[model samples]
Structure formats: C-alpha cells, structure tokens
Target: MNLNSKIEMQNSRSSSEICYENFMIFNSQRAGFTIVELMVTLVILAITLGAVYTTFIAQQRSFVTQDQITESQTESKIAFNILTKDLRNAGFAYPVYSNPPTFSGSVVPSENNNAGRDALTLVSGSQQVATLAQPLIIGQNIISITYTGSARFNLTDMANISIDGIDFSVITTCSFIGIGTDCDDNFVLTLNRGMNKPIPAGRPLYALTASTYCIVTDVTDTDNYLDLRRIAGIATLASCSGALPADVERVAENIEDIQFAYAIDSDADGLVDDQNANGVFDPGDYLTPPLPANSKILAVRVSILATTGKDDPSIEPSTKPYYSSGITLENNITDVSNDKQRRNIWSMEVALRNPR
Candidate 1:
C-alpha cells in the first residue's frame, strides 16, 4: 500500500509472468529429439551394424576356405598311403626263388592258339636259352625262370593267370615287359621244332603272367594317362633262376605324371650314394639308374595332380605360400614346363618294394 511496497508488488507480478513462459518453452524443448538428431543417431547405428556384418562374413568365408583346404589335403594323403603300401608289396613271391627270374628274348607267336599265349617267355635261373623247351600253355600256372642277359625282365600277364606258388588271382590284360625283351612284338606260334627250339631248359617254373588293369572313369582325356600294365612270370637267364615271380600292377589312377629317380648307393656306404657328392639333396641334378634291376631304389618321389572342382565353379584361383623346408615340386613330372594345373599336386616318397 506504500510506495516501496507498490514497486516490489509490480516487479513480482512481471517475474511470475516471465517464469511461466520460460517453463512452457523448456517443456517443448524436452518433449522429444529433433529430426536432425534422430537421423544422425540412426545413421551411426546403421554404420556400426554394417561393419559388424562385414567382419562376420569375412570370417565365415575364411573358415570355409580352410575347411576345403583341409579336406583336399586329407584326400591326397589317403591316396598316397594306399599307393605306397601296395607298391612296396609289389613283386613279392612266397618261398623266395633260389635265383631271380629272367625274361627270355623269345617272341610270342600270334598263332599260339591260346588267348594269353602272346606273353614273353619266363625262364628259370639254370635255363639260359632264348626260347622255352615247352610252350607256355594256357592255364598252366608253372613257369621257369633264368637270367641270361644284362637286362632284367619285368613280366606282365595278358590274362589272369594264377601262380603255382601264390594263391591270389590277378587281373587280366594289363601286362607289360620292361628292361628285357619288348612285349610289344606280335608273333605267331608254330608246331615246328625249329621255331620253338629257342625255348630254354632247366628254368624253374614261375607264376603265370598277371595283367594289371585299372578303371579310369573320371579321366577327361585318355592321352593324359599312361596305360601301365603289369607282367608276372619267370626268367630264364644268367644270375636269375628258380621261380622268380614278378607282378606289376596299376595301383592308382588320376596319375597325371610319373617320374622315377634312383637313390643309388654308388659308394655302397649302406646309405644313398650321392653321385654328385654335394652332401645335400640335389634332386634337380641327380643321377638316375637303369630300371627293373637298379638293385637300390632308396626312395621314389611321386607327384600327382588332381582337380577337385568340376567345370561349373571354374575353380577359384588362389595363391598360397609354401613352407620353406617343404619339398619343392620343381622336379615333379606334373610340374614340367607348360603345365597349367600343376599347382594342385600331391607329393610323396616311396621306398622300393624290393630293396635288394
């Protein structure tokens, strides 16, 4: 009611009105986020989710690739193991012969009246003649062998012939002759004594020749594969005698290439003789011995190239690092010059079936 009281009352009323307006503005500001802020938040969330999804996908792909690699490695190892095991047992005969079998130089006659008579003659150790005294008749399991020449013989069967000593039956038509007379010659057998007179004498009987055959269903081209045949029989020549049994078999398929290197003990140190005297494994510049009777085949390095992916996916191209100490495929047959798919190779080392 006084002058000072009147001024204070007027100021108080103005302040109250300003307070009400400020409260209303604050409520409106605090109601919700602005459009710009909402959009920025959503964008940040999308970016984070995208990064996480990308990382997850990358990891998943890596896992898949690793799994595929492991599977390929496992398959290759299995195949190699099986092949080595069988190869080591090749040319095995029960009751080892007194003298190894030898391949005779006699030509198989085409008119022998037998389906499997085209086989090269097998002689016993005592028989040194070029021809057999008795013609190797069909279904006759007994064979004599001898060694007469410097060359060793590998007898492969043209028909499934059972050995007199061995019990197992061999596959037919997949036979071969190596290091001795070439079985590729076509000849005709005659009843004349002069034509068959070259048959050797005193040669011990050997098992009938066993053919080695394999089914190559998945081959893209026949030329890419070698039709390796097995030959089992006797030898009639010099150091070779008695029932010398030889069996060569096709133990594997998909063998894109085969290379043989001899680990000869030239110095006879009871270890692989280093022909180059480099004291290190110089597979690139090493000496290879003659086959069929090399005597010491310390190790056999094999490389097989195979394709897992079919024509559809086009086989994803990739580059992988090789371990430093790992065996390089430089000398592999599959890795020869001008080979495109040699990168996909399985390598292995096999000891000879007969180390002697």
Candidate 2:
C-alpha cells in the first residue's frame, strides 16, 4: 500500500505491454509474401530457365551439324586416297608393243559420260599373283606358273606375262591344266594369243585388272545412298552406262558426283601440256577412247562431291546453297537445289608414277 509497492506494479504493467508489442511485431514479420511478390519471382525464374534451355538447344543443334560435316569429310578423304593411289600407279608395267598397242592407254577417261559425271578405268600390273615355273617361249599359248595361296585366279581373269618388267603379254584364256587336282600352288595357264615376248623362268607374272570407278546410287541399300563404285574387269565406257553388277562393291558412300580432268603430254615433252592455254585442265583437254597416236596422260584431276546423309530441318531449302556444279548426277537425277542437305567438294591432282 506504500509508494514503492505502487511503483513496482506500474513497472510490471509497462513490461507486459512492451512484451505484447514485440510479439505482434514478430508475427507481422513472419507473415507470408504478397501475391504480387510471388508472381514477380516466378516470372524471373521462368525467364532464367528459358534462357538456359535455349542455349542448350542451340548447342545441341550445332553439335549435330558438326558431326554431319565430319562424316562427309571422312567419306571424301577415303575416296580421294583411293583415286590418288590408283591414278599414281596407272600404266604400271604396261605391255610394250612393236605396233600401236591394241588397247587404249593405261588410264582411260570417259569424261562427262554417265549423266554428266566422269568415269575412269585404270590398268595396272603391280599385283604379282604368280611366277613362271618354266621359260615361256614366243608363240607359246600355254605355260607353267607357280603361285602362293593368295593367288585367286578365276575364269576370264586377265594376267600379264612380263619379261624383265618391260615386255608384257595379256593372257586371254585362263584354262587350267589339272581340273580335278588342287591347283592352289601351281597351275598351267593357256593364253589363246601367243606371248608378245619370251619370258624367262622365275619371272614374276602379275595379275592384270581394269578397274573402272564411277558414282552411282545403290539400289540394294534401303536408304539408296550415293556410292562410289569400283567395277572390276570393266575397261570400256559401256561399263559405266550399264546397271550395277550384283557383285560390285561400294568403295565410298555419300558421294554425290565425280568429275575428271586430264593433263596430257600431247607434244610428248615430258611435261603437262595445257592444250587450250588455260591454267586449269578443262573438258576440252581430256582424252577419250582411241586416244591420239602419241598423246599421253601425265596427271589426272579428280573432283568428288560428297553430302551429309540426312537433311537438316534447320537449313531452309530456299537458303541452302548447292555445292556441286550444275550437272546431272545420275540417270534421270540431277543436282538438287532444294534438298536442304550440306555438301562439300574435295579435289586432288595426282601425277602418274608409272607412265609408259
């Protein structure tokens, strides 16, 4: 009932009021966000996610395009390597003749023949498949030869009988002496035509092949991929015009077109003659079948066009550019301008290493 007791009560009351004010402030601070704040946060998160997703999709599309381009480049490189090697070895140990050679030159070119595409036939005797077991005399049609297990001689397969690697004769007939016996190691090959020159004993006999290279679409493949095909034993231009043989192999795939230009030594000066004074070898400078009497092919320019196997939807057909020159690619098929496919062209100039 004194002044001290009354002051204590008043202090306690003031303390309780302060505690209540602090609790109210705490509760107000803990209250959830406003609807407008939540919407704003959501919009920001959505924008950030959209940006990230867009970047990822762009990168994925770029990766796909690069992968396709790499595939096309690899195919082109393989085709170029094969063509360069064969062209360099053209005329390797060709037959020497007193008169003009019965066949054409070692590298026969059919320029712009197959639907505006070029065809080439290469003759080489570097693949030695057998050796003469006995001396071959002139005017002899039959001779004894020995070979290893690697020698695969089939009927109608041509072979060259060479003497000292200079004089040679082609075997037209491949009649074997022992029919019932296993002739894997040794056999007698009968040449319907007499030998051009006498080959001594122990000389190597080479397996001759006329391989023609051209671009075509394989009907056997469900995708109908464009392929570079090597037609073995086919030497004439007609070989490029006919339907593909069932036994033919696809040397390279995705090859859309092929072109050839020849550097000829028309004057026989041992150097390439431009013929038309142009720096580049044009179609006019090429040599066809039944080549001129003294003209020789020194080098060949091969251009191959390759394409990505699939069409890219990102590439607009209206904006896509045609990589190949305007030329017919196949029979009833021409260079497509709106295919929406990526394409590349690779060219190689190869000098003949064994020019006869």
Candidate 3:
C-alpha cells in the first residue's frame, strides 16, 4: 500500500484504541457517592430518628401523668364513700344530747390549726341483735327480749337501750337467763343499772359504737405516707368520759387532707345555723363551746383530698388552694408541701337518718 494511505489508517486506528480504553476504565471502577452527599444522607437519617425518639418520650410522659391522676381520683372516691356511709349511719338509734357528754354525741367535730383539715367523731348503734318483747318499765333492771338472729351479747357486754328514741341507757352487766346454755330465741337479760325511762314494746337493743375519722401518717410504710384512719371505741360511760380506744383501722391510703363542716340547729329551729353568713356552717361555726341542750345535728359536709403517692417530674407544682368551713387551708403554716404529685378532691353532704 502507499505511505500516505498507511499513515491515515494508523491515525484512525490510534483514535479508536484511545476511545475503547477510556470506556473500559470508566466502566471497571466502583460506583460511589461523594463525601458531601453521604453527609447529607446521614443528617437526614439522624433528624428522622430524633423526631421519633422525641415523640416516644412525650407519649411516655402523658401516659404516666394520666395513670397518676387516675390513682388519685380512685383513692379520693373510696374515701368519700366511707365517709358518706358513716355519716349517714350516724345517730342511728342513738340519743341526742344538747350538752352532750364527751364522745357521746351523734356528731362531734374537732378543728385543726390548718384551716381545712378537721377530725370527726360519730356515734352509732350497731345492728339490732334483740328487741323488747314486753314494755320496759322505769327503773327496771331485768328485761325480756326476742332474738331475731345471732345473739352476740355476752357477760359484761355493754348494751344500749334506745327508749322512745330519746333516752339512752347502758347496761354494764348482761347475763342471759338460761340454764347453762347459749342465749338464743327469747331470753332474759339482767342489767347492772336500771333504765331511767320506760321503753315501749318492740324497741330495739343495740351495741354502741363511737368511730372517729381522721388523717394520720402510716408509720408501717417505709415512705410514711398519710392514711384515712378510723378509730373505733365502745360508747360506754367510761369511754364517753375518757379518751377513745385505740382500735385504729386504715380506711384509705395516700389520703392527704380531710375537712368537715357541720349543720347544726343550735336553737332547735330545724334549720342550719349559718353563723359565718357564707351560706353554710363552715370553720367558725364549728362546735367550740358545748352546744346548747336543745341543739340538734342536721347534716354534715365532708371534703377529702387524696394523692397519687408519688411525684411526677412532668407536671408543674400544685398551686390550688384547699378550703374547709369557709376558711382557706394553708399547707405551710402547719404541714404543707408543693409536691408535684397529682391530687384529687371529693366532697359530699350527708343527711342523718335518725330523728334529731
């Protein structure tokens, strides 16, 4: 071939070989992103995970707060029910005294230095175990009764005779007139003291009980939380004159506060004597001096505040105020805390069933 034709062919061959090498080099190398691109992707992943974590934390806090609030509400409700039952049962088959002996009245209130916190004492007659078969005469020491069910009366067991729903007598000595056997059905009871007034036939015989409700610390628990305590005692002559027995029972747990307001007919006018002009018998109207002989208890207003028993970090400190009787309760003056624990308040007004 000619020299010029050979040179042109060599040049064309060289161009084709260079293009092939470039294509091979480009295809054989590993494909990857740049540092900037990788960094942007990582930042986006971190943001997404942060958002998810934040949402999870918020939801956890909400659940915990709700659970604590529910616990407080439940405890408050339980305390309210117990107080309602006792208040309704107060004065049942019991006498009303104007200047009542200590712990002998249907309702007794004790005021605390803290405005809204108060303690209450209630007198009630237990279930009727016996009924008068014959009319009980005045100054009678022996009585006849018909047992409706179980006879729980024993020797030296203090018995109460509700005479015409006015006069009350306590029997210090009680013995069944039976021949060495259990007292059942119709029986006789010999009393140590005679009745001051006559009781009609079919009058009920009951065992007296004096229950005092108060808030006290639960020393048995490691945390030493407060509890709604019920202290029960027999309403005998000695107990009425002296301090109450220490038959303590924990009614509800985590009870923070309890307050009481009484409705009293101080003049026997069959209406509440609102001395504070706040529309109810509140703090200042509490029985400080002994009530007049003709005064009668009509109703009672009760307030109970309960807590979750644990502090929650998510919630703010409580700023709410507590009130009882028309006075605001200050926690710090006596024993107050601004714990971040959830709290619930329950209130009720109960009317007495027995005649006042």
Candidate 4:
C-alpha cells in the first residue's frame, strides 16, 4: 500500500475509536434519573403520605370518642349499683315498717340544696361482724349495739348512729367502737352499764344510719358539669329539716340531673298504677314528693341524666341539641354547658324491702 493511503486509513481508524469511547462515557454519566422522573416519584410519595396521615388521624379520633363513652357509662353504672344496694335495704324491718318511719325520702327544698333533683333518706339496722348474746346499751363512756345483719359496723364506716331521733352526740360516748364480747361474740359498751334503755326485742332496734342522694357542683368544673353525692349521717332524716349533714361524698361525676318520684300501691295490688294518665301515671298513683305518712312510701323511681364531660368539637361548639335541661345551673346560667356533650337518661323502679 502507498504511504499516504496507509496514513489516511490509520487516522480514520483512530477517529472512529475515539468517537466510540466518547459515546460510552456519555452513556455512563447519564446513569441516574431526569428531573421530570424525580418530580413524578415525589408526587406519588406525597399521595401515599397524605393517605397514611388521614388514617392515623381518624383512628386517634375514634380512640378519644370511645374512651369518653366508656368512662361516662362506667361511672353511671357504678352509681346505679350503689343506689340499688342501698335502696333495697330501705325500711329494713323484720316484717314490714309500720311506725312513723325510721327513714324518709324526697328531701325538702332546704335539705335538698339544689333545685332540679330529688333526694332520698333511708335507715336500716347497723350491720354486725359478730353475733349478739344480749341487748345493746348506752354506757357512760361509750355506746355499743347488738347487731343481727351481715353489714360490718365500725366507727370509721359509721359517722353518727341514732336511737329514734336522738343522735350519738347526745350519748356522751367515746367515738371509738367497743370491742368487749361475751361467749356469743357480743361486743360490750365498755361504759357504766347500769344506765341504758335497751331497745325492746320485739320492737326491733337498729343502728339508725341515714342516706341522702342528690346532685351538686364539684371542684373540677364548678360552673357547668354536676356530680351526684350522698349526704348522710345523724339528724338527717331523724331530726327536723334544719341543717344539712356534714358527711358528704361524691357518688359519680358527669351527672347532669337526678329526679326522684314515689309510687304507691293504693289498692294494695302487686303492680303499680300509672297516675296522671299521660300513659305514665294515674292521679294519686305517683307522687313527686312522698306523703308525710310513712305508709305512703311504697316504691321509689329514680331518674338520672348523665353526660360525657368532654365536648365534641365536630359540631357547633357549646351548642346542644336540647334547648334546655328545664332549669338553670348554680352559675345562674341556663342551657347547661356551652358545647356539644352527649347525654342520656336512665330510670329505675325500686320496691321497698320493708313497708307497711
């Protein structure tokens, strides 16, 4: 081959080789993604994150709602159980209550304290942890009683025990419970036993405890929410309507309202008659306030209105479905809480265990 031709061929071959190498380097450098692809990937990721966030929010809200509902229901149920146990012991005489009443209910305006709800007072025999061989007595330094029921009687559990209408404060006895007992496990009064009027065996003597259930304001929310409380002890029902009892305890919270009504078996029939004919009661069948006579109190109907203490913000804030609870609160403000709080009313009829 000619020298000029050979040089031209070699130069052409080198240029082709260089061009191939340049193409390979360019392809390697372009290995990643374009701006448009990156943008598309980001949009997909954003959609996925938004969906996950929405689900998490919904679940959290559901948990809050469930918790509120569970708490309200549990509190209400507890109150109901306590009331049932106490009311079942009302007028707890051997056969039936015949006297002017060791107890009374639907407390008057002065004792009730609040306007919307009703209160009830019940009396029963002091429960005993041990048996009794002899009669109970009031001694010089202490007062001890012969007990017959299953309820345990202790100084800590009992504030003021009464004999008829007389409170323990008048007995001039030590506040501590006596521990003296005979062969039958009967505890002694540990006082000057010479003086005391033993409650007649047939007449039946009791420890004389009293209970009053009503609605009142609590420390947490003194303005809107209300709580159910039991006011009890000496001189509550036994004495005249003068002052409220010192012993008070909260039964439940979020109790919006409580109402008490009396039922009578005027005809001595087993079933209660519906009075007022609104399909609810017949005239003289139900009494808002029990009659003064002890025999008139046959059965009691308790109605409790409860609510969730928390507000549901999904609705208009502070705006309730019901216009009013039919009365104003202690704050002198009407329409109850200023938010949407769920509420419900529960009613129960309890028959007197002992009645004339």
User: Which RMSD values do the candidates have, in order?
Assistant: 15.3, 4.9, 7.1, 7.8
lDDT of every predicted structure (CA atoms): 0.39, 0.69, 0.66, 0.55
lDDT by residue (1-356, candidate 3, tens digit) is 99999999999999999999988888777467789999999999999999999999999988988887887787678768978898898887676554223344777764433444567778777556777888988888777777667645543333554544555665544444466334444556776567778778898777556677877776779998888877775432212222433366778888877766566787767777877778865555544323466577787767777778887777643443432122233221223354667666677768788635
lDDT by residue (1-356, candidate 1, tens digit) is 79999999999999999999999999988999989999999999999999999999888866765565555456545655654554454344322322222222111111111111111121112212222334454444333334234433233322222233332222222123444432221232121112211223443323333222222333345444422222334332221122335444344434343233445544446676665668776564333333333244455554444432222122332332232222233332222222212224665655554443
User: In model 2, what are the clashing residue pairs, if there are any?
Assistant: none
Top-scoring candidate (lDDT): 2
Give the total clashing residue pairs for model 2.
0
Which digits, one per residue and each the tens of the lDDT, describe model 2 over residues 77-113? Answer: 9878888888888787776452213346687775555
Better of 1 and 3 by lDDT: 3
| TM-score, cand. 1 | 0.42
TM-score of each: 0.42, 0.76, 0.68, 0.63
Candidate 4 C-alpha error for residue 326, in Å: 7.0
Off by over 4 Å in 2: 1-17, 98-103, 133-143, 159-164, 171-183, 192-203, 235-247, 265-274, 277-295, 312-336
CA displacement after TM-score superposition, residue 15 of candidate 3 (Å): 17
* Predicted structure 3, TM vs. truth: 0.68
Local lDDT at 108 for model 4: 26
What is the C-alpha lDDT profile of model 4 across 1-356, one tens digit per residue?
99999999999999999999999999999989999999999999999999999999988887887788788988998997788677777654322322322334322222332344555666654432323334445443344454555443444223223343222322223334355212121333333223245443223234445666766666567555677877665434323221432367778999877666667655566556557656665434656643434324567666677788887555553254354453332212235545666666667777777543
